[model samples]
Target: KRMLAFVAHKPMKIPGQFRKIFYEDFAVHRDLLDKIFWNLVEDSTVRSLNDQLDQVKAPTLIIWGRHDQLIDVSCVDVLENGIANAESVIFENVGHVPMIENPKATAERHLEFLAKN
Candidate 1:
């Protein structure tokens, strides 16, 4: 049931039916992630980012998994509030990388968001 829902997720892509594997595959590089993401994990860094977020005028779409374990979901709310023209959609049962766990839905949401602006 869970797998079917994932497979049914929104976006329909032309070339990469196997694209879901990419996010899962990419996550394997834990060392690199820690090296890069740690800088943004700090409160000062995240808060500082809000200032820049305010300056961004592009239409933005934020897709977050409510159950994400790696990064706190609260950050999504922060980003949503900071960015002026941003929309957020949360997948309640998903985690940090919903793209991997639920590629279809992720793809659908991404395409839908992209089409609007």
Candidate 2:
């Protein structure tokens, strides 16, 4: 149950039949996950993006999940305040991956951002 909950916003929401397939995919992609960790997580620059946010000149749309446990929602303020032209829209019931938890709304917000920009 704990492992299932780790990948999903609410593990109860996931159909039981799909759970097996999800875990199977994780096993198959374990190597890729390890590579991502070494390439991104272990990289020092990724930890200090705040200092470089000011370098971003393009119009930025910061979409975050208010319930995200992986990355705190408070970081949105850092990006919004640091970036020259930035906007944000947070999803209340969503978790770490907004696109997976609420694809329709996420895609709609993305389209709206593109249209406005």
Q: TM-score per candidate, in order?
A: 0.64, 0.79
**Where is the poorest 10-residue window by lDDT in model 1?**
3-12
Best by TM-score: 2
- How many clashes would you count in candidate 2? 0
Question: Please, what are the lDDT tens digits per residue for candidate 2 over residues 10-56?
Answer: 64566767877897889999999989978876675657778889999
Quantify all predictions' global Cα lDDT against the true fold: 0.74, 0.84
lDDT (Cα, tens digit) per residue for candidate 1, span 1-117: 343444433323534546567656766986798877776677665577667788878988998887766567798988999888999999867876678767799999999988888
Candidate 1 displacement at residue 54 in angstroms: 0.2
Q: Can you list the residue pairs that collide in candidate 1?
A: 9-104, 9-105, 10-104, 10-105, 10-108, 11-107, 11-108
